[model samples]
Target: MSFSKSFLVGIGTGLLFGSGVTILCIRLQRVAREMDSLSNAIAELATQMSVLAEHLSTLRGFKQRKKRNEFYSASSGDEDEIFEDANLSFISSDSDISKGSKNRSTEDKILDTHVLFNKVEKLFEGDEKNQEEAFRLLSRSAPQHSADCGFHWRMSKACYLVSKIEKSRDNPAKAKDFLQQSVDHASSSLKLDEKCSSAHRWYAISLGSYGEHLGSQEKIKNGFLIKDHIQRSIDLKPNDPFNHHMMGRWAYSVYMLSWMERKLAATLIAAPPEAKIEDALESFLIADRLRPTIWKENLLYIAKCNIELKRLDEVAKWLEAADAVPVQTKDEEEAQKEIDQLLPKYQTS
Candidate 1:
């Protein structure tokens, strides 16, 4: 081989290596830029998460306040001291304030409470006719507040009152109408303060109950929307067990309704092979954990699931628990009776 040829070959090899190194460096720099972008994205997400956590904490504190009657007391001082009593002033005439602007002085707010308390007292302690009159007056008088009353607190209060009235009504259909109105009011309340977590929670629950009511009447798709609203509620406040309970209830209904849908479909097309029964069982189990026996709907679902699974002992236990808790309405009573009739058959087996 000639000397010139060998020298040229070595030079070519060196140039090729340099080119490769330059390309590799460019690739590494591109990768580094991508890493930086990802880091920025992660940082932004972290900030959003922090904000969400703060909001959720505030919501939880509000929900806890309701149990203590914090809203009922005239003193805005020390929330703990205000709600130490289980029952609040809103339940009584003397304690409730008439509709008014929020700019009212503290003294005026207290006076309003005093008047409301008297009215509520007269309503409850008074005759049935007086009670009806009082309810009308109180309903007419409920405040349209100036400031944002957290969505859940305001709506839940309305729901509680409306549900009570519905429970006393002679007609199941009328009771359902009352709950629907509560849901409507709550939905409207959310417009007052969209961030109110409790509003979303109660609204979701009202919708769920409405779905169940519709289901009992053979209204199928209406219940599906209830499930969707509950899912949104969970998204809004992921930590709230109350909303989760509603989700569980919806899931159970969906599973059962799926079967009904399938049966209906079978009449038209070939029935799909039996759906995995385990799917329904898993949904009920999830609901059982989220709410246990906190709501009648929850207990009823768990009992139904146990019955389907042939867990006779669990069914008995659930029925006992249901009875132990106060049944909310005549419909609830009738439902309980039906379940009671089913229990003995399971026990014998």
Candidate 2:
């Protein structure tokens, strides 16, 4: 071959080999980028899977054998659950209220106060018959006229005393009527001075009793107004834990009714889309925080919320906590037991 032809062939062969090497390098770079993108996507998927797994752990202990219909049927007659507290202690004792009078001789004031205190003590400690006897004595002996003392103050004292007696009687009907009377007298006292928190408290209690009455009659439509009365009570006495507890109860009742209704209807029409489950969860959470140990209703709502949100794991956690806490009374215990029995069934269904 000639020298020029040999040089041209050599140069062409070198260029072809160099071009192939460059193309191979470009292919390798593109493959590395694709691999990096896939790795990032896999990491994100793993994080989401971890979150989902944690959520599922909460529901892991829940049994899946029970049916939803069985749970609902068992919970249908939840009437006794409504009256969880019939034995809560009233706020004040007679001794707390009856300090000795200045005008009456010290000896006389002491004597009167002791006797009244003893009567009240007996009223609270006694059964139905003894309570009635104490009530009669209080009606007869309570100073008919604290004339030199303020009339409004005396009226409040009288009303408060009667309320204690009636509450101690333990007869719902009589207790309610007496509470209404107390409310009227308290209102009269407040009309004389509108800023009296005591009067407002008394009125709120009366309103609560009225709400209970409506509930007892199955007037759920009317009973919806209980929230207003309870809210007013909270506003009037923000310092009192009792009123706050009542407010919690009020909110719980609303949340429960919403839940029950939602379950029956298959969806929430009253609550917004995001709010359907979230609203119930929010209310129950507030109630749970405000009064943790005593709020079985709060826990119940939380369980149901977790169920609706499909966070079975959370439901199990809350149910465990609920199961550990004593239910406070026989009725509460029974109700909780029923709920416990229903949990697995409902979850499976």
Candidate 3:
């Protein structure tokens, strides 16, 4: 009676022990594979950081170019030399930018810059914080996604913020340099993805700033390109209010060209760029409708366009709307300051 029972018990114990060992071996193999994968990733990241350091070291050597003559033709953009100077191009080609035909978001993050885009958006969202910190984050994250168009545009935005943000404005030379970097990063964004609306939008805006800060010739010459790229941005993403506001700015500048400026353009350019106050007003109004109470700049420009049209009542109406917009950032404070300056003149007129 005891022999059969003992034999059966031993067989069962042997089978259980073998099963436990098999499961443990499988788990150990899995953990080993994961560790190897993690180690490889860390090594690759270290290599990228090293390469990025070299590129950025070269970037630190950037010197400001001398001002061009006023007679410089406003025909072509003539910006190759500036880009050639910065030499900040990145070759990171393995970043995951595989969104299909249209943009699809991963939960809250849009534009694949390793979720840094969301962080960057928040950096500009609330009361202004350390500008240098934002620039550092973008620079640190850039090399890993150098081939990613998203990183380039975001880097351009960070450069813009450092250039024009309140305290940063104290250093005009640094601001100007950062502004050029903004243009360079933004242009790189376009080279990587021409169809990207944000890239085109930022590129146009940065180019416009470079022209405005650098010289009148640059502004007047880049005007057509700004108009074209901003138009493309609008065409690509019709719902973006920022694009509409930019388009309005282009139109307003054209309509406000002085008689001398107009004569010069007519003489030099066979078909000088043309725009009307009504067109600007229309674009501004559309932006107003698209995002109410967000952009006081859009409201101020709307008032300016109306002032041009001799619509004093409408001017007052828009100024009131501009005044109502809550000011958070220094940029918003500056926009409000402009409104304050314009209010007395328009109220009396």
Candidate 4:
């Protein structure tokens, strides 16, 4: 889109200032070619980034895990390893946001922030009631850390989960509203700190969800941006399993675009996203290996990707794996039902 804009503006300005059409046309055409070359270079760079993300994701935890193994080997003890988060930088009670509340002690402000953060964190258990309550609290809370990026990202998450609940309840209008809120809060988070990976992740998720219902044109319009943000998230936090899972899902969606959808994208989207089912399967496999059985949907999608690839031999294995995962939430139950429906066809075949 920027490419088109630059091309048009350059040519228009050239003609408006009484420049010769021949020279002007040649100059602008060269510029267009250079822009196209730059765009292709960008696409190649993106491919490299995805490859680097997948290869380095497991490396992040290797040193820590190896140290733990060495400690256990020497101690000959079976105590669960404990990791403490010494980074309590977000609990800033003395920050400018708390200037009006001079009466509150620093400890009190810190405690209140932790309490609010914990409350929101606990509500992410996929319970609709809990998610709704969490959203309400996030909407009303005015803590010292209210301006913190961490707080806004959590708000984005709470809004996203509430949107999920509304979507499950078939309340499309309400769901859309919450999804927008999710996107807005995520923008606030990014504005505070562009380096935050989870903010990028939630922002991608919320925008993708919102785009899904806006028909083909809007989906195409948001496709590049949604993908870029998610890729940025993966590059920043490669060790996070959910980030890989999201990349897999995004790949699968693009790979499965219908004939008409592809045509629309070709016509309307300057740089429509592209992916192969193989890419989807590879991402899903990486996610599975990173944290086996962590998410029922991940396993389910792995099976679905195999089915699409005509790899019937591999499909049941993933389906069975998904089945063995305990169903703890409504989403997991639904995923299990899908796995059940797929399991029989492949088992008998």
Candidate 5:
């Protein structure tokens, strides 16, 4: 009986030892996984730091340029006026007053619209207060202005400009309101003249901007409309670089949407618009080809798309190109910051 008890005790001890070993191995595996995650997190942090350094360097450069008044020269003068007029010309033309007032003649109304357009153009370069003043002036005259065919386009441009200023001020709700007004004016312009490419472009831009303030489901719902309007703009003006850039931006935004966001979108909508990084890259490439060095944002966007696709080698080239592009407006300065952040990652890699 003693011998039998010894053998049973040995069997129990063996089982306990084996169980302990198995538990230890499982714990080690869990630890290994945790270490791997930590390592990845650290690497990501490092990359972000490198990008931040680049942005700091760009900021320094911007300050130096400011001291030398380079930015002022780049954004001012006759060249600047011509550029603005080219984009805002929908309102620059003369138009007879649809409403006959005993006091004002057709020529007088046309001259008034022209003067207002010039005032708004000058205000475009001013501060937030200036933009608000411009908005007030435009608002007072919008009804009478829309009576003139040229006024529709001008009012649309004014609304868009105000929305952009609001967005820059971090008042997205106010921006959305202005964008809605822009859309209304753009629609009126299109109704009066269906072939107005600028109207289509501004309309698409307003819708896209408005989408940023919407809920996930509403954004998805408007995504289709945004795509349609942008495409129409491109069809109307195939050679316009801005239209292609807008298309690229749309694709990039769609591609960046998370799976959960997409699922939520799908549940709310019959069919959500689909986008791929490849499409975004192609659109950006086409825009770059059309405008060359006109915009740094295009190059930065291409680099971002490449990074998403894990094409690390190509990212450096695009970033370098972006750095070479001259920074002028606030938007370009913002793009410069992004480029500065990204350029260091690939350079060190």
Candidate 6:
């Protein structure tokens, strides 16, 4: 009887210990999940703070520029004062004062356009809501300065940005529409000022983006135009890293065409521009040298291009670099997602 009681007591103790261990493990898993949630929340908060800081810096720059302009006008002449008083005091009905006022108004409009453009540019690193707000503000102000070349160029860029936002939201049709608008604005800017390198660059980008949404035949037909504009942009701004990046993307797109696609392109149009992975790799390398790791997409594209060329070593190198780039925009985050998937596969292989 004593032995039987001792065995029953042992079994009871064992069951209690196992239950305690199971409870402890459940608690540990819950803590881990909560820690992961907190970590993600902190990361998102940091990104938002960074965007806000950049927006504030842009605003500060605009204010400084405005003050400088005001000081310049004040020290230059009393003409502005006369115009100001003309409406209030009416001491002078001089037509010269009226003309001066008109000129000053035009300058004011240009300044406003500049400030707004800077705001939009800075907001590109922000969230979709912020981008939408910037787009609305630009759309409202840009139309007022239709004749301003800088305004037109900035508007083209704004459209392109909005197109990207739309694309991210899975609205391809709207994105293409925005790209078309970008092309129109860029063309207008060039017509107003033929030497505007920004206009040319954006025009090429918008044209390429628009063509990408079209049929293969249409893409072939527009291929030369895209290449010509990209070259023009590079010639106009040789030091611009973005122009080099654009050239690289163009080459990559062309190199991605399959034999069937190339044959169809040839049938549709005469002599579509030749493209090789070597050219793509070279262009991307140039861009990387010029602006080293500032754009994660550039690194991603370089990796992809290297992969296409069967240079797995370079591909792994670029993929590692891309993993190190900070995610600023949603697009960059998406690019990082792709890198996350590709890195493990190629790294292990």
TM-score, per-candidate, Cα-based: 0.48, 0.40, 0.66, 0.68, 0.63, 0.67
Q: Which of the predicted structures, 3 or 4, would earn the higher lDDT when compared with the native?
A: 4
State the number of backbone clashes in model 2: 4
The reply for model 5, stretches above 4 Å from the true place, is 1-119, 125-130, 148-150, 167-173
lDDT of 1 at 334: 63
The total number of steric clashes, by the backbone 3 Å criterion, in model 4 comes to 0
- Please write out the lDDT profile of model 4 over residues 276-337, one tens digit for every residue: 99998888888777666555788889989999989888888888877787776776778878
**Model 4 ranges with Cα > 4 A deviation:** 1-104, 142-145, 213-215
Candidate 1: how large is its RMSD? 24.3
Best by TM-score: 4
List CA RMSD, all candidates: 24.3, 31.4, 14.7, 24.9, 32.1, 27.5
Position 245, candidate 3: lDDT: 83
Writing each residue's lDDT as its tens digit, candidate 2 over 150-196 gives: 23323333444455456655666666676566556555655654544
lDDT of 5: 0.67
For model 6, residues 89-166, the per-residue Cα lDDT tens digits are 111223644554555555445445545765665564356676677778878876577787767766776787788888
**Candidate 4 to native Cα RMSD, angstroms:** 24.9
Q: lDDT for model 3, on a 0 to 1 scale?
A: 0.68
Q: Tell me the deviation in Å of residue 271 in model 1.
A: 16
lDDT of 1 by residue, 26-122 (tens): 5654555566555645654565456445444443443353331211111111111111112111111112223111223543444444344344433
Clash numbers, per candidate: 18, 4, 0, 0, 1, 0
Residue 281 displacement in candidate 4 (angstroms): 1.2
* Candidate 4 vs candidate 5, TM-score winner: 4
Off by over 4 Å in 1: 1-138, 146-180, 205-224, 235-241, 258-297, 320-335
The CA lDDT of each predicted structure is: 0.50, 0.47, 0.68, 0.70, 0.67, 0.68
